[model samples]
Target: MKFRSLLIVAVALVAWTNVPAKSASGVPTYIASAVTDSARPPDDKAQDAKRKPDEVLAFAGIKPGDKVVDLMPGSGYYSRIFGKIVGTTGTVYALQPTEMDKAAPKGLQSLKTFAGTPAYPNVTVLVQSAAAIAIPEQVDMVWTSQNYHDLHDPFMGSPDMARFNRSIFDALKPGGIFLVLDHAAAEGSGLSRTDDLHRIDPAAVKAEITAAGFEFVGESKVLRNAEDKHSLSIYDPSIKGKTDKFIYKFRKPLS
Candidate 1:
C-alpha cells in the first residue's frame, strides 16, 4: 500500500509540472470592473482593444487606497480608469509636463476639464516642468504610457534623464512599482528613433531604470506585435494603433 501511494504522488507532481502557464488574457475581477466602469468616455472604451487596459492594470497591481501618478497623462485615458480602480480612498495624480502644454495647449484641455468634474474627484492634475518632476507625496506606483520617449525629445525640454529617473526612484515608497509602456524601436537603435519614430529600444529603458536603483521585476508581452518591422514612425497610418510596444515593470528596493 505504501509503495502504491508513493507512485501516485510522483505521478501527480509530474502532471502538475506539465500544466501550461496561465494565458495573458486573464483579467482580475477588480481590474475588469474598472475597465468597464460606466463613467469612462465612449471614445476611451473604443480604444480598449488596442490599449489592453485590463491586462496592463492587472500587471501594475494597483489596488484601493494606493496613491498613483499618471506621469505625462496626455488625455487622462488611463487616468480615468485608474481613478475608478483606486476608489475614493486612493488618489491618482495626472502629472503633465508644462512644456507639452506650451507646445500644444488644446491637446490637454479635455483632461484638464475632467480633473475638475465630480466624476473623478480623486483625480488631480499637476502641471510642472519636465526637468523637475514634483510628485507631491511618495506614491505606491508611478506610471507613464507611450510618453517616456517624449522625455528624450526637445518638446519636453530634454530633461536630464539620469536625474529624472532618480527623482522617480525617490518619489516611490520602498518596494513601490514603476511601470513604463512605450513604442519599441529596433534592438540596437538606442535613442536614435525617439525623435522621428517615437519609439525606443527596450534595452535602453531597462538600463536606465536599473541604474536608478530599481529592480527589473518582469514584463508583459500583451502589447508586443511580432509583425512590427521596428522601422516606421509610430504615427504612420499603417502602424498607428498596431505598432510594436513594450511594457516594463520595475520595483524600488525595500531597504
Candidate 2:
C-alpha cells in the first residue's frame, strides 16, 4: 500500500511537470507566479499597486506558450514579466527602437545585458527603427504600455502611423491581440499633448488603430484616475505615476 501511494504521488508529479503553468479553470497559472517572481526588480514590484499587473495580464488574455512582442519595451519592465508568464516553451520579443536607444544608449545596453542573462532565457532583444517597427515573426500578442504616444513624436522618426499600424495588424496571427495602455488626455486633445504633456485622447487612438483593420475587442478602467482633469503633463509632480490612463485591446480577426 505504501508503494501504491508512492506510485500515485509519482504519477501526479509527472502530470504537474507536463502542465507546469496551468490551473484547473483553464487560466494560465504562470501569471500569478510571474508577478511574484524573484527575478523582478524591487522597483518594478513597488509599482504593482498602481500598474495592476495581474489585471492587465488577465485583460490581455495572455497564456502560457504564447509568443508576445513588447513594443518599445522601455526599461524591460513588462518584458521580464511577459517572459515569465510565457514560460520556457514560449518566447518574448522585447523591441527597443533604435531612435530611443540613441536617446539613451545605456538603457538599451542594460536591456540587452539583462535580457541576455539566464533569468530571461526566453526573451530576445529586437532592435529596430522606430518608424519601421517589425516583429521577427507573427506573435500571439503585441503590447505597448505607456509608449504608444511616442509613435506620434517626430523625434521617434515621425512614424507614418497609418502604415505603422498596418504593419502591426499584419504582424499578428489571426485572432491575436494588440494591447495599448497610455496616459489619458482631454477628449478633443487629439495629438496635441503627446510631445509635451505626454498624454493622448483615447478615442483618437481607437479610431486610428481600427482604421488599420484591427477590430476593437475591449477596454479596461483598471488604471483610470478620476481626479485627473486631463490638463496637466503626465510627468507633473502632482500626477506622475498617478495620472489617469486608458487600456485598450484590439484583435486581428481570424477571417
Candidate 3:
C-alpha cells in the first residue's frame, strides 16, 4: 500500500510538471523559444523606416495559427515575418494593390520573388485593386504599415480608399484586430501633407479608420519621437529616413 501511494504521487508530480503553459485565452502558448537576432532593415541603411519586426509583431499581437493579412505588403517585408510567427498552420495573405504594379514596379518584382521562394512558403501574394481584395473569410488580424496615407494619393483616390477599408472591415472576424503604423505629422493638419511629407496626422488616421466601424483599441508610443516637430517632410534629407511615427491598434466589434 505504501509503495502504491508513493508511485501515484510521483505520477501526479510528473504530469503536472509536463503540462504546457497557457495564455490568457487558455490556449497553449506558442512563443518562439529562439529567434534569429539579426539586425533589421532601415537600420541597415540610415533611412527613416518603420518598426522592427519583433516590435511590430508584439504590438500587432501576432500568434501561431492566426490568419493575418498584410496590406500593401511591399517587397514582402512584413509578410515574411507574419508567416514565420503564424507557423505552418497559419496563413498570411499579402495584399498588393493592382495599381501598385504601375505605381511601384520595384515592389511588384519583389513580391513575385518572395512568392516563388521557399523561405516564405506559406505566404500567398494577391494582386488586387485596393478597392476590393477578395479574401475567403474573416482573418485574425489586418495589418497596414506606413501606407495608410497613400490612400489619399491622387493616383489611388477616395473611391479606392473607401473600398480598401470596407473590405478590411468585412474581412475581419468579429473581435479581430486592425493594426496601423505610419509616420506622424503635425496635429490638425489632416492628410494634406501626405503627398509632400510622406506622413499623416495620427488623429486623422484614427477618425478615418474608426469611421470604418472599428473600435479604437489602443495606441503605442514604442515608435514615437518627441523631437520631431512634424513640420518637416519625412523625406527631407534631415529626417527623411528617421522621422517620428505613430502606432495604432484597432479592433472590429464582435457583432
Candidate 4:
C-alpha cells in the first residue's frame, strides 16, 4: 500500500512541474514588450498615424531572430515594428523605392534617421528601384503592404513592374515567405484603375507574383468585407480609411 501511495505522489509531482512550464512556453516571451513598444507612435505620425502595426505584424508572422525585409517601407511604419520583433539578434532591411529620391524630398532622410536611432539599430535602409533592390543575402521573409498595385500601374512603366517582382523573388531564400496586403477590387478585373482607385484585383496580383516563381501558399480574409460594393474607389471619402483588403502569403518552393 505504501509503495503505491509513493508512486502516485511521484507522478503528481512530475505532472505539476511540467504543466506550468508548458503553459509558459506557449506564451510568446516578447509579445508583451513588442505590444507595448508598438503602441508608441512613430516620429513621422503623418505616415503611420492611421496604420495598425500590430495587425500588420501579426499577419506577417514576425518572430524573434527573423531576418525580415520591409519592402517599400514608407516612413518606417512596419519597419519599426519589425525591428522590435526581430530583436537584437535579427536584422531588418528597409527597402525604399529609388523614385522616392526624386519624388519625396524627405523620404531617404527619414529612413536614415529611423535606422540611426537606438530603437531601430538593427535596421538597414536601402534605396533602390523596387524591381531591382540589391541585398547582400536572401532574407527569411519579404513583406509589402499597400504597394503591390504600384507595380502594375502604368505610371511606373511596364518595364519597372517586371523588374520589381523579379527582384522580390530573387531576394527571398528558398522556403522564404512573401506577404502582400493591398486594397481589394472586384473579381475578373485586370489591374484596372490601380493608380486612380488605389486598389488591385486579387486574381491579377496572384497571377503576376506566381509567374515570378512563387508558390501560392494561402490567403487570409481577416480584412475582407462582403459589404464592400467593389465599385467605389478605395480613396472615396466614404471608404477611404476602411476599404476591404486582401492578404496573401506566398512561399518560394523548396526544390
Candidate 5:
C-alpha cells in the first residue's frame, strides 16, 4: 500500500513539473533585450504587444553572434530586431522580394534606409526574387515571419516550392534553424486559405519543410488563440492584432 502511494506521488510530481520558465515562459531574455534596446525604432516598438517579438524570437532559438537572413523583411521589423540581437560580431541580411519596390515602394525604401543607417552597421539590404531566394552564403538561421503563406500565392508567380525549400535547406549551416511563424488557418484548410485569408495550415508547412530534409524540432503556442475561428483575412479589423498564429522551428540535419 505504501509503495502504491509512493508510485502515484512520483507520477504526479513528474506531471506537475513545468518546463523551465525561460524555455516556455512569459518572455525570453534575448527577446527582452532586443525589444528594450534603444536602437529599435519607436514605431517597431509600438507593435510589440501584437507581434510578441520576444517570445517568437526566443522560441526560434536565435542567439548572439548568429548570422541571420530575415526573409521578406517587409518594413524590416524582425530585421531590425535581429540586427540588435546578433550584435557587432553577427550579420543580418534584411531581405525583401525585388517586387516589393514595384508594389510597395515605401516599404522597400524603408528597408534600404534602415539597413544603411549607422545604428545597425551589421545589417545589409538584400533584394531578391522570392521564387528563387539567393542568400549569398550559408547562415546560422533564416527567419520568415508572416510571409510564408504569400509564397504560395500566384501573384508571387507560382513559386517553385521545391526549389525554394531546397534553397533554404542549402543556405543554413548543418543543424542551423529555419524559423517560420505565420497566421494560422483552420485545421485541414491546406493551402486554400493562404491567398484568401492570408493564413496557412501548420501541418502543410511541417510536411513541406520536413520533405526538404529539415527536422521538425518543435512549435510554440504562445501566439495561439482558443477563440480564433481561423476564418477571415488576417487583416480583418476584428482579428488583426489578435489573430491565431503558429511558430515552427526546423533544423538542418548535421551530416
Candidate 6:
C-alpha cells in the first residue's frame, strides 16, 4: 500500500514539474543564442514574443556555416539574428530590392549599418533588382518573411513572378531551401489581397512556387491563428501581430 501511494505521489510530481521555456525546450543552442543575443536591439527583442524567432529559426534549420539570403530584409531583424547564428564561417546577404529603394530610400540603411558593424562581419547588404536578383554565389537558403506579398503590390511594379521565382531558384545551390513566411489571406482570394490586405492565399503561393520548379516540402503551423478571418489588412490593429501566418518550405531540385 505504501509503494502504491509513493508511486501516485511520484507521478503527480512529474506532472506538476514546470515545463521548459521554448528556448530550452528542444530548440537548438545556436538558435536560442541568436534570439537571445545581447547585441539585438531592444525593439527586436520586444517583438520576439509575437515573432517566435526560436521556432522560425528552428524551422529554417539554420546551421553555423549556412549561406543565407534574407530577401527584402527590412530593419535587419532576422538578418541580425542570422549573422550571429551563422557564426564566422557563414555568410548572410541582406538583399534589398532596387524597387524598394525607390519607394523607401532609407529603408535598408539600418541593415547596411548593421552589416558594416564589426559585430556582424559575416553579413553583407546587397541592392539588386527583384526582377533579376543577383547574388555573388549560390546560397544554401533564401528566407523571406512578411514581404512576399509586396512583390505583387503596385509599388513593386509586379514584375514577371515566374521569372522572379526562377531567379530565386537559380540563386540557390542544388537541394537548397526556400523558406517563405507570409500573412495568410482567404482560402481562394489568390493575389487580390496582396496590395491592400498585405496577405496572400497559401494555395496561390504554393502553386506559384511549385510552378517555378520547387518541390513543396511541408509547412509549419507555428504562427497560425484561427481567429484571423482574412478580411482585414495585416496592419490592422485587431490582427496585426496576431494574424494567421504560414511558413512554407520549398526545396530546389537536386537534379
| TM-score for each model | 0.89, 0.88, 0.81, 0.80, 0.87, 0.90
The parts of candidate 5 lying over 4 Å away from their true place are 1-30
Tell me the whole-model lDDT of each prediction, alpha carbons only: 0.90, 0.88, 0.76, 0.75, 0.86, 0.91
Residue pairs whose backbone atoms clash in candidate 6: none
Candidate 4 structure quality by residue, lDDT tens digits, 105-192: 4756767877948778899988876446787688899998887787666544444555667777788889889999888888887788
Model 6 misplacement above 4 A? 1-23
- In order, what is each prediction's RMSD in angstroms? 5.7, 5.8, 5.7, 5.3, 6.8, 7.5
TM-score of 2: 0.88
Best-fitting candidate, measured by lDDT? 6
Name the lDDT value of residue 16 in candidate 1: 92
Rank the models by TM-score, top first: 6, 1, 2, 5, 3, 4
lDDT of 6 by residue, 56-91 (tens): 888888888999999999889999999998999999
The collision pairs in model 3 are 47-241, 48-241, 48-242
Q: Write the residue-wise lDDT of candidate 3 on 50-167 in tens digits.
A: 4444455666688888999988887766776677678878888888888766788787677677663666677888888776678876799999888888878776654455566777
Write the residue-wise lDDT of candidate 2 on 1-255 in tens digits.
999999999999999888746545444577878888998989889999889888788789888899999898888889999999888889999888898888767757767877857999999999999778778889999999998998888778878889999999999999999999999989898998899988889998999999999999989898999999998888789988999989999999999
Poorest 10 consecutive residues by lDDT, candidate 1: 19-28
Task: Estimate the overall C-alpha local distance difference test score of candidate 5.
Answer: 0.86
Per-residue lDDT value at 58 in model 2: 77
* Ranking 3 against 4 by TM-score, winner: 3
Best-matching candidate per TM-score: 6
Please identify which of the two predictions, 1 or 4, would achieve the higher TM-score against the true structure.
1
Query: Where is model 2 poorest over a 10-residue stretch in terms of lDDT?
Result: 19-28
Per-residue lDDT of 61-173 in model 5, one digit per residue for the tens?
A: 78778999998888888888898888888999988887655666777788877685788888998888877788888999999988998889877776888789989999999
